[model samples]
Target: MLISMKNRLIATLAILAVLGLATGLIFPGKHAKAETGKAVSPGSRMEAPAKLEDTAGLTAFVDGMMEEYMNRLQIPGAVISVVKDSRIILAKGYGSSNLEQALPVDPATSMFRIASTTKLFTWTAVMQLVEQGRIDLDTDINTYLKSVKIPATYPEPVTMRHLMTHTAGFEEGGVGYQITTDPAELPGSISETLNKHMLARIRPPGVMSSYSNYGATLAGMIVEDVSGIPYNDYIQKYIFDPLDMKYSTVVEPLPKSFIPYQVVGYNSETGSFIPGTPTFEGGFRPAGSATVSAVDMAHFMIAHLQNGKYGEQQLLKPATAERMHSTAFQFDKRLPGVALGFAEKRVNGVTLISHGGSDPMFNTEFYLAPAKQLGIFLSYNGGQGSEAASNLLQAFFNRYYPAPEVEQPEFAASAESVQKYAGSYQFTRHNSSDIDKFFNFFAQLNVSIAGNKLSLGSGSEQQLYREISPNLFQLEGGTDQIGFRTDESGKVTHMLLDMAPDMPLERTPLLDQSKFWLIVVGVLAVLFIAALLGPILFNRRFKAMTLAEKRAVRLSAGTAGWALLSFITLFMVVMSMDTMQKFTSISPLLSLSLGMPILLAGLTLALLVSTIQVWRNKYWTAIRRVHYTLVTLSAVVLMIFFYHWNLLGWQFG
Candidate 1:
């Protein structure tokens, strides 16, 4: 059967994910344990550690994994450390300090961009306030929040707890030029940011889970409003100082003292370092914009591992830690049980708490299994860090906790409720470039327990997962509840999904991206015909008119043609890099859509230069030679550019 474009994208992603995690699914020779005395290279199979009970092998495993994963991901550098059994086991670095210089990575003192992981810290501070009775979780946030006003979602005010779990229902804004040119605007106080980004809600607070940076910023706003301290300052005084995380800071402009080992963020296309991703100096630090090494990150993770207590110091009550791990909003129990700021996943039935972080071009993930005394902190500068971490997680479970065999379920029970949601799927972020550093390429499970699957890119879609059996699943949320409609003869046809009162989804592009592009083109066509072509087609006379009529017609025709060509050129240049570089094949005098038009202009200039020589009459021969040379250079440059860029995937048409 022929597959659609959307279906093809899903299949390709499944293959990519499986191919990427090759080692994880099929562990052949070695058991998943780390060996002591004989150090096994990270990323390769390891012999089970002789002293399985000893913490030493686990320590080596942690350090080795960090270095190994960084290289696999092309990360500029990483500072990863592991805290197990309430102690720092390994803190190390791999790859280059600066992507340009390709220097050795820093181990102990290097810094990095920790991105949204900063939210965990921000949540930590907010919870600290909660523990102290300075804030109430369920009360309306606007009561404490000042300096900026939030447009409440409903007549009933939403609570702080709602925003904490990303159920605040705030629609997201595009990043890019804003984050690049005016990162300072992001750092403004929380209330100020709330006022700045107060848009309409997507759903009632706590009804559905939708991730929002603006929500976290508001949490940061309340922390500042009620505590009477700046966001980062609060984190330092309460969390960082007490935890002895000396190297940790919400990096804004990055301190000069940190110049030594700090990794420079890279833009892969230009092969240039991206300086100034602007960590939180004063504002918006809550939603994640911070930097630290594995050592410091390990300390933070270990504290959580030990349940909000470090040594004898009780940073947070053990009960509160339990609450943090427990889902405040079970907005999703399918993909993973996401709580306030963390996620709960059962790897082979062993529950673990995990959170992922990403910045301009860096990623960090921490998974802690308090049940098994296991913790993993993975960091890399490039986006591939997540896949590396997943592989490491597989190795980790193999070493510490091998996949246990499950007794077969009864035949009746196995087949009784075999739901129709089954198939692999992935999620691609909307309205963004491939080079974006945001959490744009978020992993979404297409989950199916039986034979059914969810569609990708549908709006207001509720993505859910339900395990029917090990390695089998079903989608539970709105998007997962897909059915089908048929013709009078009862043939399988259009799909029925729970999108706004359980409506039928047409098999066609009810809201396909290309359809929108077509609408735009249709509008342009109409304007072109009515405003430009219509006049010519409806002209009164055919041939033989006054010179004034001829000139007027020519001027109008030229103006309209130029305008139409301009829009077409812009559209082509933006949509397909394939059309940009041009050769003589595209007509040397082709319009601006193909870059050869510039070369043709150069040829005209060269001819003009030669004609000036003829008029001067002194250096006619020399000028002729010079003109030919100029034209030749332009032609050569055009050809070279077209050839090189085309060879590198810039196709000319």
Candidate 2:
């Protein structure tokens, strides 16, 4: 669920920035220790093979690591499974599954939600159809659908290849309809649900990578159409049956047999564990609704590592499995890219194909090293599961396949070249035409020149990069690489990070930066406050004004100032809600707040007429008339800001 973490982090940072601005404090800077890139001579290094051979050693390593992570992160329960050379190295569970009942997690029976990792099964099902010549990877996806049809937005049609690599160019959505605790909210059918709420195509097919849940769901529907079976039933019969995975299922409100072994999820954000209500993905189930046991996950991993074969059963042809594991798309050749469905990354001098998943309460990580015939699956239930999984992965790779340090490439760039890349950039996996976009205002990354190197982000999360070649920068002491894309005029337009191949960052224009909008808001705040105090402090001057002048004063200063201030106050309140609450559903309070923009637009139009009248009639001193004009201009600016953020109307849909 690295993608989920990225998206949520952006939103979380935005909220923190706004809160910090209000308190006259921005982000607090904390320097991180630089990574050591010292080389170890071959004779000095350990003689152990760079592969998983000793099961006892792995068990000790994993046990120590998981215990430390559980205590440090306050994670309630977790499961870890490792497979090597088609054999299970270890499959174990740790901690309490249900704190209230003191239930311990059972590796053989306890089922945990694997979130987006479920997409692998969906993709596998598609490959099965491909092997049978029932579906073509390059053909238009619309041809295989019977109920929902993809719109012809661009000249090039969206193909299965685009969906597999997340290059279909669909804008991200699925807020209110993504997950729910109520069974009544489940859609009657996937196609019917898609027909009612299809995402708009924002870019041409096969242009760029942007993670999209809707795109994956569409692929699942294609599987259903080609196989003439329901998606859930198809997976159960073809996959689970062949692998003999008894405790795993994609069905929501778990099948009767699985209910007893289901693990309870927990939220540990408030320094205490609180049981979370069960949530279902409804029609979006195919995208991330798989509840699986760690042992079951090991089977799935072993089959993939063995090239789609589990004992005598062949889930996919050898040739088809090889193609699925090969790289299918990549924005930059120098950066880790995407295979058919797996995200490719190079860690400790070893290429590992992996996928991460996250729900509100569960997090999972799956990794396979084809060269070494090793696979690892880890899942934990708690608020800090993602962080715990990340820590474990880094430690596991460093212990097994230590990287051999090489000489650093030397390259210097002119200050002007470095400055050109300095700007605010936003992730492509975001909403561009909806109220969800408002959160993006706070999620931008600010790049700045630091001596001869470049700095990315701010505060504790900041990372330093040095240029290794033209437009390609490498992390100071790490293997991570970031490449910049320039337009025909040599202006940097986008950046691609080696670790994040599914979402590219686009260079934000000046007007779109939060700093620009914050400055405008600050200026308007001062003007509105002065307008409100002007009449109150100068009562004698106000009484001396003529009837027409008084009317103009009230419209320009009295009504406009209060209305704008009211809208701003309401906006801050809406943004202060819990992150999940904001995404689950639009509250009534927010719905009412959306109408404030329309009211402000009318008030601004009236103020514009008042400004002209005051100038034409010479109602007051020249200074007073000029002040009225300035107030009217500020009102217009506020309207433009509202329009840009999609606050001008009800844009939740």
Please report the candidate that would top TM-score against the real structure: 2
User: What is residue 585's positional error in candidate 2, in angstroms?
Assistant: 1.7
lDDT of 2: 0.77
lDDT by residue (tens digit), candidate 2, 560-623: 6656665676578466755455645677877777787888888889898888888888878899
Residue-pair clashes per prediction, in order, are 17, 2
Candidate 2 regions exceeding 4 Å error are 1-51, 458-461
Tens digit of lDDT per residue, candidate 1, span 36-72? 1111355343444233456677668766765665544
Model 1 stretches astray by more than 4 angstroms: 1-72, 99-103, 176-178, 181-190, 269-282, 332-335, 407-509, 512-653
> In model 1, what lDDT does residue 82 have?
57
**TM-score between model 1 and native:** 0.63
The C-alpha lDDT values of all candidates are 0.51, 0.77
